[model samples]
Target: MTAPSSPDTQAENAEVIARQRVMRVLAQAPDQQLEELYEKFADKPDWTFARKPETGLVMTRGRIGGGGAPFNLGEMTVTRAAIQLKSGEVGHAYCQGRNQRKAAIAAFFDAAWLSEAHKQSVEANIIAPLEQEQLTAKKDKLKKAAATKVDFFTMVRGDG
Candidate 1:
């Protein structure tokens, strides 16, 4: 009942998806890890703060039983920043907690990812490793939780 997307539209959607993935990884990454990766970059491009890092509280929402009515789960601290590369690419980041430095670094990487010249290196050195580490951590946590899982069964009585 809808028209198919054109090639240009598809390409734009793909670009938006890729940027979303990058931002998701950056937002979930630890501040220490982001700082370390930022330090290791060989060519850090010059960038100006389009918006200075600022901390604020955001209301979080949750659904009851995963599918029921949604409710506010209280507020959590969040920091956000925006940066513009010298070449005109603009990047923005939002992260949990009050780590302004982390937000700035993440915004820098977001802008870097937008630039063709820096995308590959940023993906390889920063995004890939962080993704791998997070994956490993998740697996380990699941494994540990799985170890404690219990199964129960009842024996039937013949007298019935």
Candidate 2:
């Protein structure tokens, strides 16, 4: 048997997850939108890249019909960045395609979002709107997809 995780560990894990979710939303938003959101911050916090944004290829995988055997889909381009705020908070972002600046902005936003100074503004103007946009897009896509979905069922007749 293994020991239970400490409260600190749980909190750390939660923070990591939140950061990842923020990074994902940031990655999906347009650069213009993110930059506009960044303007909401009262005072711009200075940040430096822990690692400069760079592009690379990642192999994507897909499962047959969302189940069964998994197979390699294809290699896709991805950009990643890591930034550290002056106050010592570190942020990392990974985004699809080759947009180094976008990745950097996202990483910087991630770091700034975690800062107590910018947390409320980030949540209100950036994360909330982006999340709502994502949710709307997802719902629309699902509705479209559902329209074409085929459902087949068999009915047992009492007479038969």
Residues 1-160, model 2: lDDT tens digits: 1357698888888887887788889999987777777666567788899999999999999999999799999999999999999998887889898989888888888888888988787777788889999999999999999999989776878864
lDDT of each: 0.94, 0.86
Q: How far is candidate 2 from the true structure (C-alpha RMSD, Å)?
A: 3.4
* Number of the top lDDT candidate: 1
Ten residues in a row with the worst lDDT in model 1?
151-160
Error of 2 at 23 (Å): 1.3
- Residue ranges of candidate 2 with Cα displaced over 4 Å: 1-8, 63-71, 149-160
> What RMSD does each model have against the real structure?
2.5, 3.4
Candidate 1 lDDT over 1-160, as tens digits, reads: 1368899888888888888899999999999989998998988999999999999999999999988999999999999999999999999999999999999999999999999889999999999989888889999999999999988666687853
